[model samples]
Target: MFNLVVEMNTQKIRKDFPVLEKGIIYMDSACVSLKPQQVVKAMNCYYNEFPACAGRSMHKLGEKVTEEVSKARKIIAKFFNAKPNEIVFTKNTTESINLVANSLGLKKGDKVITTDKEHNSNLLPWQNLAKRGIIHEIIKSNEDNTFNMDKFKEKIKGAKLVSMVHTSNLDGVTIPAEEIIKIAHEHGALVLLDAAQSVPHKEINVKKLDVDFLACSGHKMLGPSGTGILYGKYHLLEKLEPFLIGGDTVIDTTYTTAEFEKPPEKFEAGLQNYAGIIGLAEAARYLMKIGRKNISKHETELNKKITNELLKIDGIKIIGPEDPELRSGIISFNYKDADPHEIALLLDSSADIMVRSGAHCVHSWFNAHNLKGSARVSLYIYNTEEECDKLIEEINKIVEL
Candidate 1:
């Protein structure tokens, strides 16, 4: 009886995220996930037991706290199948990308390939580089929101760097990453993956994938905000310039000149978000224990059930990959005559279903695809089938209005 069935262990899981205390269904994990008890406790441990700065201290308390941060780096590196030296802590995904973008030795006439599907976080750095005479080419996504791989390859010829959003935030379209990375490597183009959405839902093997650079935010994955990761090959990071000066990033400084520390330290400037990052480590551990495969399966089922039922309502249009397996937890759609914001308001007021309805920081994608806006329902491992039923019920009422 159990052979063909796999049920997520949500009872134990829901207890971790205390925000369920709201007495409402929270379904917007794609935007920012609710924190678990362990994550909260980790933050508490820092403040209660040993609250001190990381990486530049002689006192026992400071050294111990710093070691925890260092241990977190090792855990993150092992998770990605990389060495500890490859990861750098940043404020969020945007800051992570900027660390690399500003550090690059890019100049006039250098080429970068990206897509219209990218959020502003992934798109703006290259656009800014374009103003300095660096070339930025927008690879168009097909009508169904899938990337055109053949066209992407054709565009990669002679490009110095290629960067794309790993999973689109607007439509939840997962690009064929293995193909993209392989082709980019063949073309001598460095690939950077904006994996803000993918990290929380999918199994990532940076070693097996051989992706040069990757960025993700902790908040999007059941962790704290003001926290994120930037990963790069050690050699590439060593070659890039420093993003900021002063403080620990510098090895030595005088009135006239300064020398910077190696790769990871060089990128992290000033005092950082210690507590948020500590919570991020705890969140990653929680996800690993539960298993990413199980998480993906649970969310895919929810997306399928919600997508099919929502589409049955008259005048509704579902966006992104029709195949639930092609994406993860996000479901973005719109009603023909109904505004997305209005729809969201009704759902929240009447059904207590929490979701996000807006451009979701991907305005370029919407304008490129000729869409107004969309209502998005993103699920996490803690979400249940009963919540899906309630959402479907509320959507039906909204359409009838």
Candidate 2:
């Protein structure tokens, strides 16, 4: 159903993001998205109009802040087709996954399976569990970077949990999340999806995916930084223990013993990011208005257009899957005898193009494959065909020189 490619009004959509008018071609949405004016204004209203703590003070401003926070939670919950209480606020995707890893109560010799394509956020959490006597098993992809479902099926046996990245930042490879989730459930293993890369660009229904836990960041999806969400089924959340304690996380506490709050409140500790959360709600609303399916189609078309032109260069090499249809909005490439960092600098200085280079926080994957990093170009709803043409024109100029 998601494979359908529809057209988007790029010129009209571009007006929503103020940064696009600066003549800078931003292709780094995978790192962090450009926030729309609506999102920024939402945050400003939180600080300027109602500058009060939620659920703490009894003043009118505090009451308004509490209502806004509750409304924001419902908005985010509806965005992912999840219950409001199932959503837990976090610092970012890194903290969200760590919360799951530490709270899962892994025991000595319990097996946890993951893939080689995972970003450091998903990979490091499971690896850290090894110090606690948990066994971390990694499933390697094929030489062509395609997932080997047979290998995944073989390793999922007797596994306590299966964690995977829904979409890859390294190469824009989108995994078969539904198929993977089905296999993990059959083996009686809990599944967690790192949706930081996928959720921003496409639609993800947690109940439909049937994932035990899912993590994504607000900053990567057009909200403010230092805000994220961890969605867990109520039953699973009740079974897992809370990693952080004290403050509002507990309903009551004594010096000797404490009674923690339920589900989300139990996971969330200390003062929350009120402004960022409100901004994130506005961001979700903005994306919802645009339609996730349409955004996906627009990004895929842009990636294909740029990739087709890049392939015509003699020394150019595309990373990850060969087909543009199989990838997300990200496209990574490297040239013969040219350093990726130098090429990126040239693009930034010469054309004011913004792109990311180097390991992209997947250093272990690059080291395992015995290769250097590549330059990456990621797109979003605000990007345009003219920007793509300019990027290609500059790259071709480099090749000729």
Candidate 3:
């Protein structure tokens, strides 16, 4: 069923974002969401007020920074139903996946399973493991581009890790991650979910899902850039190796050997994005304030409006699931014989409609399907129904032109 459960105040929410006032209809939130005033303020608070290093400094400013950072960690952990220690701040989703890939200690003969629809962040890490003699198995999607659980079940055998994207950026399809996690565990394989898209729109309980690890970016979820997190079960973290090490990662050090700190610390080497972390915490709070359930429903409602109108236009092909409920605020499509890039540029120049038109970092999927790229319109809370109308109007104009 469609998940529109909460009542939303779109006008109020739109006010928090200044860019909405600029007359530009931003439909590329899946690429990078515009930062709200609260997030920007939080970042500014760090730089202007208490700009200092965290964890290492013993001074007052340092202590304040460390305290704010710890609180941010707790807030992020709570959102995922994870322990505070389980959250390891990384640069972005790519680094988060790379952290798991590097630390998993995969041998030449070990198997890693993923899907054909994964963004390169999730796909390439596992592919790179092949050079270490680690085998990579990719399960093909169904004809409609939906994840084929049957194929997933067939290929998960003898796999050391099953890493998958929770949501497809290329098609806006949401995978049944809980079911996938259960099946992978039954087969004695660890599961990692690339939640870069899912975390922004819905509430995810890692504990309930029983996912071994997850990676997400803050930038896509109303937080600052250079901020993201890798979450691993505490016990499993103890087993995985640290991807990067130096500075605060170690508890004790000698000229030749060093004793590393615990999981989160060991993984976070050197200086971190202190401002980004604090800003991310504020963004998390902002999302919670509005409620993820409410955000999901609102975005879904908006997506359905656009989807319904788009389907009526002749020669316009909507990608992913036919059901608007399944698309999750992202609508990617191609017009008959029209280049997606050219369409995107025209839309921008004509009406200030910002959409993403490219392989979207899932070039493997595009290449496999023998297509070039599709124009994508991704929504967020700040978008209005009026904006959706304008988008449809522009699409019609483009098609006619």
Winning model by lDDT: 3
Candidate order by decreasing TM-score = 3, 2, 1
User: Lowest-scoring 10 consecutive residues by lDDT in candidate 2?
Assistant: 1-10
Which predicted model would earn the best TM-score? 3
Clash pairs, candidate 2, are none
Candidate 2 accuracy as TM-score: 0.97
Model 2 Cα lDDT, one tens digit per residue, 232-351 = 999999988999876778878788988988988899898889999999999999999888988888889989999999999999988888788777799988988688888888899889
Q: Which pairs clash inside model 1?
A: none
Report residue 28 deviation for candidate 1 (angstroms). 1.1
lDDT by residue (tens digit), candidate 1, 1-401: 11111655786788787779687889888899888989989988888887888888889988988888888888888778889899988888998888878888888998999987888988899989899999999898887889998789789998988888998878788888888999999999998999999999888889888899999999988888999999999999899898876678988988998888997998888887778778888988988888888888888888888888877787878787677666678888899956788988888999788899988899887776677789998888888888899999988888777
Ranking by lDDT: 3, 2, 1
